[model samples]
Target: MLKIQDLNAFYGKSHVLRGVNMTVERGEVVSLLGRNGVGRSTLCKAVMGLVAPVGHVEFDGKTISGMAPHDIAHAGIGYVPEDRAIFPGLSVLQNLELGMKKKGQTGEKWTLEKVYEWFPRLKEREHTPAEVLSGGEQQMLSMFRALMGDPQCILVDEPTEGLAPKVVADVAAILQQMAKDGLAVLLVEQKLSIALDIADRIYIMGEGEIVFEGTPEDLRNNPEIRKEWLEV
Candidate 1:
């Protein structure tokens, strides 16, 4: 579980996240939807301690606002940034191996074999360099690499961006499976349909603040909110 209260972040003199409040409960998927430059990715960075935050970030009842990124990660939070930051020079297997908190320490929930079972393409390309993989494949690799750490919660920023429809569907299925396996997922996505389909709850952000918080059905019923904050 993760909770953020009165979270504010800045990039030099420019304030990005403005008094944001949100939560992600275990075994649930919460989607944060917004257009470009609405501070969605900044919220993820603030939660991960990559950006300096001016409020509380609690993980499973413990405050973690000012902790180092590595410490935050060791405390059971995983982050997959929008860029799909994988080691291009490393083999797929090696990249996954690097995700482990401790060498040779298998997680109770996620393992290399389980990840491969979920995405067979990864297994087939185990020895191939990560740079050679397709964009969708690279995204999958980035996400599964985070899972290798066996995090209690994951912050996925734009996981489906630039992917084909089928790959986006595959990404959606993986997020659903992660929730079923009891990992809290906080997804920052631009795809409204995908978010509406998989999220238990939705938060729409605009001008660095949350403008709407509701279930998918509530969002569907509120055309005004969609037009004002979500639609392109």
Candidate 2:
């Protein structure tokens, strides 16, 4: 549902992404894996128009490069940053209600009720401030805030970062459900197992370029790629 080609990005003249290219098919869970210093996050930021890039970013079928971040969000793309951007003082319900996107199809997948179904804890804590949530609840809150947009595609950067194993499993399960609901997911994660669990295809990125692309099994078998991009 999204395609990025020959994209290059920079932060204050320090180029991060170097002619990167990748595609996500409808309903696909595509994972982009890389070491800490690689440009996985940069690529996601560039696609969402949070960072400047020179090249093509197409969503569904139109070019979105150079668009403002708000316009990109309105174009049916949801982004969950590595750092969970929850409003510390806002109630859980209020936070979720903020993600009504302008371009997504009106579907049954991500209504407030539906999000609560996926995360019953959210229902239980409807009035709680975001700062009071545990790490796992905060992660869920961050995701629900974006999902409430009913996005056609989601860019999840490090959904499992800084969470416990059981919490990671919970997050992984939600991502699987999102894929099952036909929303394309482009994930950038450090945990190989978490990415492999839901990703239909994987890309190993380095120095702003995609160095490897394959199925989960293919990645597992390529010891060099695993050692280099993951297994840190």
Candidate that scores best on TM-score: 1
Across 207-231, the per-residue lDDT of candidate 2 in tens digits comes to 7789999999899889988887677
Local accuracy of candidate 1 as per-residue lDDT tens digits, 11-116: 9999999999999999999999999999999999999999999999999999999999999999999999999899999999998998899987757899999999
Sequence-dependent TM-score of model 2: 0.95
TM-score against truth, every candidate: 0.99, 0.95
lDDT, each prediction: 0.96, 0.87
Best by lDDT: 1
Model 1 is weakest, by summed lDDT over 10 consecutive residues, at: 99-108
Clash pairs for candidate 1: none
